[model samples]
Target: MTAPLHHAGFFGFDVFGTVVDWRSGVARAARPFLQRYGIGVDPFAFADQWRALYQPAMEQVRTGARPWVRLDVLQRENLELLLARHGADVATLAEDELADLNRAWERLDPWPDAVAGLTRIRRRFPIGTVSNSHVAGMVQLARFGGLAWDAILGAEMAHDYKPQPQVYLKSADVAGVPPHRFVLVAAHNGDLRAARACGLRTVFVPRPLEHGPGQDTDLEAEDDWDLVAGDFLELADLLGCP
Candidate 1:
């Protein structure tokens, strides 16, 4: 049997996909940009392809091949590559226009239950983000989504990305909680597995539509996690929140 969540001192949440709808949000933001460039690709496909570069871009930093730069930098680099691949006339775009398009990540909407569920859970325990996003981006995303976080903790803080032990350990350290007492709530099984290996309890909240309608991965808990909830509302209930 799993231990009660009340015993945990801090909850570290994975922001992208887990708390927000990245695909739909990015696609919405990309639609107009694509049309302006006369690109005929599907916006959602563009979103997916752009996202496909996320891990590899971060991997460069994680492997020490590149210095620790913010996720914003990596994302911008990836965006340039994606734009080139799609035959967009990148040089013709004004700096502000390109930056605004990159800022789409900051403007994502939360999962329908996210804000309310976090509010309920926050009534009982401290909650914050353990995301790959930088501080500035996270601040904007929180403001846009109305996600009231107690703190922002993750890759930016640790100078590394997810599945990296330091990201989880550093977040728990920043929260002033022992690794064993800090619970990580994430949709990705690999993320939870990594956190658990670092001594944090894991809660898997699978987001089936995070990758779009035909998503085949992370649809359900893939291991015997500390807890598995269908969504944040259920997570709040399991946590004994009001």
Candidate 2:
């Protein structure tokens, strides 16, 4: 026999593609690099490549091919890869400009419903971001977007990136909640699948624009999540108001 689910406890969540608009931030960062130091390179393509490279970079850590590198190193690795792909180099840019680009994740705009959804969740449950993003970046984003988090949980915190069970399970410990009492809200299906594997409850909300146009997500709600919503508002509806 099973017990009724507790509605009030703790929640683990994904922030990069979940609460914040990573694509918009990335695109904005690309334009400046393209305009200035991109050196006639296809920066739109670079941004696209940069975004695409995220998972594989984290996967390197997850699979033990690389050590527990933070998201900043992974982003830098992807940045250098994109530069190499175009036969360009980073030496052309001032150190300041290069460092600024690394801060893009810090400036991600929150989704329309993120503030409201998180605020609502906070009334009842402790909420934290379980993402591959660096701690400093997520902290700056919270300040940038006015997001309220009970705690910050990330690859930087756990020292293990996502798709790894250690990273996901650590969310509950970081937020001081039992694993079963927490829910992971994420936009990416792969992310949600990982949380589901950890015996953490899950809610999926679509970030259709996370990759901009022509991006096809696994829109099919998997059997894993306890709830699937088109966006954060619908998630709130399913979870009920605090």
Rate residue 59 of model 1 by lDDT.
93
Q: To one decimal, what is the Cα RMSD in angstroms of model 1 from the true structure?
A: 1.1
155-175, model 2: which lDDT tens digit per residue?
Answer: 777788887888888877777
lDDT of 1 by residue, 1-242 (tens): 25655589999999999999999999999999889878889999999999999999999999999999999999999998999998877888778878998999999999999999999999988999999999999999999999999999999989999889999999999999999999999999999999999999999998999998899999999899989999999999888899
What local distance difference test score does each model get? 0.93, 0.77
Poorest 10 consecutive residues of model 1 by lDDT?
A: 1-10
Query: Which residue pairs in candidate 2 collide?
Result: none
TM per candidate comes to 0.98, 0.91
Which regions of candidate 2 deviate over 4 angstroms? 1-5, 41-44
